[model samples]
Target: MFLGVDVGTGGTRAILVDRDGRVVVSEACEHQPIHSAEIGWAEQDPDDWWHAAKTAIGGVMRWARENGKAVESVGLTGQMHGCVMLDADGKVLRPALIWCDQRTQPQCDWLNETIGYERMIELTCNPALPNFTLTKLLWVREHQPEIFAKIAHVLCPKDYVRYKLTGEYAIDMQEASGTLLLDVTYRRWSTEVAAAAGIPMSWLPSLFEGPEVCGRILPEASSVTGLAAGTPVVAGAGDQGAGAVGMGILEPGSVSATIGTSGVVFAATAAPTKDAHGRLHTFCHAAPGIWHVMGVTNGAGLSFRYFRDTFTPQLGYDDLTALAAKVPAGSDGMLWVPYLFGERTPHLDPDARAAFIGVTASHTLGHFVRAVLEGVAFSLKDTFTLFEELAIPVEKIRLGGGGARGPLWRQIQADVYNHSVELLEAEEGGAFGAALLAGTGVNAWPSVQAACAATIRAAAVIPPTSAAAMQAAYPRYRRIYPALKGVFQA
Candidate 1:
């Protein structure tokens, strides 16, 4: 059995997967979120991540032992862009700045206007978003320069978890790709970018590819997690990289659609290619040497969660989806732009707001729910067009996440994307992907490909069916964003 550990903002999860890729045992531990009382602030305790990870893993191991699954290796993937600063004694200096925290907008804008957009994009393959690690560091530098000055090294969320498991200082390329300090093309830290960001060279850890084994779990960690002490622990990537692996989108030209707390449209590329407008992000894939372009929508599944809370009283996802299925394509001219938490792809505005347009007396609650689903699908298509422009030929796509849970949403995605979307037989997302990386590390399989072949399986595929009217309505949906771009800024 391979153990995959995923440390997310709200919780920590561990899954024990068998040779056939089925989850034999799974466990999770939820933690509280911490934040600054001031405006636009969010933070999580790095120690919370470590505590939750240990508990989740220990729980999974206890269950796996009862289930007769033998532990082989372990892998970890975590929420991206968290700034975990360690004091000289390896203690967390402050609470981790989490992935979705938007307090660094001032730092982000300053970097963009001062350092210049083209230079940063060319260096990092992305804009200086407030969510990125560099921006978070800048926030610390300005707000708590004393703590910043005392930093020994910085690790992303997953890297901090890996330190607990292996007692090693390491990180993966894909995680570093989000930091804005890595020269993405060169696959190393950039001195120019670091100096510009006011970060020192000594603050970063040595980076590795996702599939490589960084070190072995120490006996102390073994005592806590109930795993073998010398078990190989792989240097896992951030959540998105693990999601790509989970969906079997590691091959070139393969595309993945993932929606959990947020949404992502990831297209694998053989060579590194940056989006010309710096609207999309380019990153190294967990698969050795390959790269991927990803466009993130900050609130897809979570938006549905909000809508369900507002409209339906205790209706589950299936009930809501069934209600949506009653409504026809395009929601009968009722268009909903789901930018409630602000848009991410194509338009990089955190200030972007959502609205329902073309509503009439004919539109019902079912129609509204259906419109939300279709709206999310249409938003994903915006990112898909970027992959097309780069000629990153995508045929069929693998779908995962809470959005991928319903057959209705899958069908909507196929129709809107005008392509087939297949589901992974294994349900766990990043956790399972991390286990596959661990399997590769332990030589449990000859390579990452072999592990995937031995374990990963497909569940279902939704193919694009009839919808000439919906296809025609796509242009109108595309225009809504442009018409509202100015309003979004306001």
Candidate 2:
């Protein structure tokens, strides 16, 4: 058996997988809700992640022991771009500014001015964004200099948890790509950018490939998590990278559209693919010697969640989606802009706002709900449009996350993207992908691709049924954003 742990935004999940890639046991422990004392600011306690990881791992280990299975290796994965600072004694300096935090636009501007936008993109294969770790660190340096002064080590969320588990400071190339501090073309820390940003290279963790063993489980972690001390722990990718591995999106032309809290359209590439405008994020893939380009929609599933929580509290997600299913393809010409947390792909504007446009008295509640689903899909389709411009192939599109689970949303994605979408037979997501990396670390599989090929299989495909309607509506959807841009900014 191999173990995988994911330090997710809301919780920590641990899963045990057999040599064949079957998940034998899985457990999760939720953390406290993210604290957002002010708008556009999201923070979480790093210690909370450690506690949840211990609890989740303990549960899975208990199951493994009862089943007479021994975990051979462990892998770690989680949300990317979160800035977790530690002092020389390895204590958390402050609450981590999470990936969704949007209070660093001023810092982003400063970086862009200091390094030039194109040059910054040339170095990191991505532009400075509020969601990136470097900007969050810069925000701290400016606002909370005391904490910044004490920072002796820097790690992403999962790497911080790994530090607790193994007493080692390490990060994977794939996760480091989102830091805006990596020379992604070379897969190393960028001294130029670090210097310009007033950051020290020594503060960064040691970089490793996703499937390489970077540390061993320490005795202290073993005591709390019920694992044997000295078990090898592999460097795993971030949520997007590992989730792609779990979905078998490894080669060029293979793509995935996942709608979790955020939406991502990912395509694997043999080389690092750059977008001159910096719309798509080019990052290292979990598989060695490969790269991926992805576009993010910050408020994909969140759009539907907000609608459900705000207006239809009595209705569950399935109930809301069922209502959406009753509506026709284009929501009777209504459209939604899913910029609740500001836009990412195609537009790097953090000040962008959400809106419902073209609403009429004839539109019902169902139309509103269906429009939200289609709007999120439309936002994701922007990435596919960028993919075409960059000449990235998209021969197959696999669907994952909350959007893929619902029949309505899956078909909606197919229609909006104007392509057939596939579903996996057993999509356990990042933790499962981490387990595959763990297996690769121990030679249970020759490589990440082999582990995926042996274990992952597609279950179904949803073809585009309302392509013409969506194709027509998409142009109008495109127009809405541009027309409302000034209004949103105001």
Supply the global lDDT for candidate 2.
0.94
Please give each candidate's TM-score.
0.94, 0.98
- Per TM-score, the best of the predicted structures is 2
- Kindly list the per-residue Cα lDDT of model 2 for residues 14-44, writing each as its tens digit: 9998877788889999999889999778999
Q: What is the lDDT of residue 220 in candidate 2?
A: 93
Worst 10 residues of 1 by lDDT: 33-42
lDDT of 1 by residue, 159-272 (tens): 998887888889999999999888888899988989877788888888888889888989999999998889888888899998788777877767888877778999888788
lDDT of each: 0.84, 0.94
**Position 301, candidate 2: lDDT:** 84
Candidate no. 1 TM-score: 0.94
| Model 1 lDDT, full chain set | 0.84
How far does residue 75 in candidate 2 sit from its true spot (Å)?
Answer: 1.0
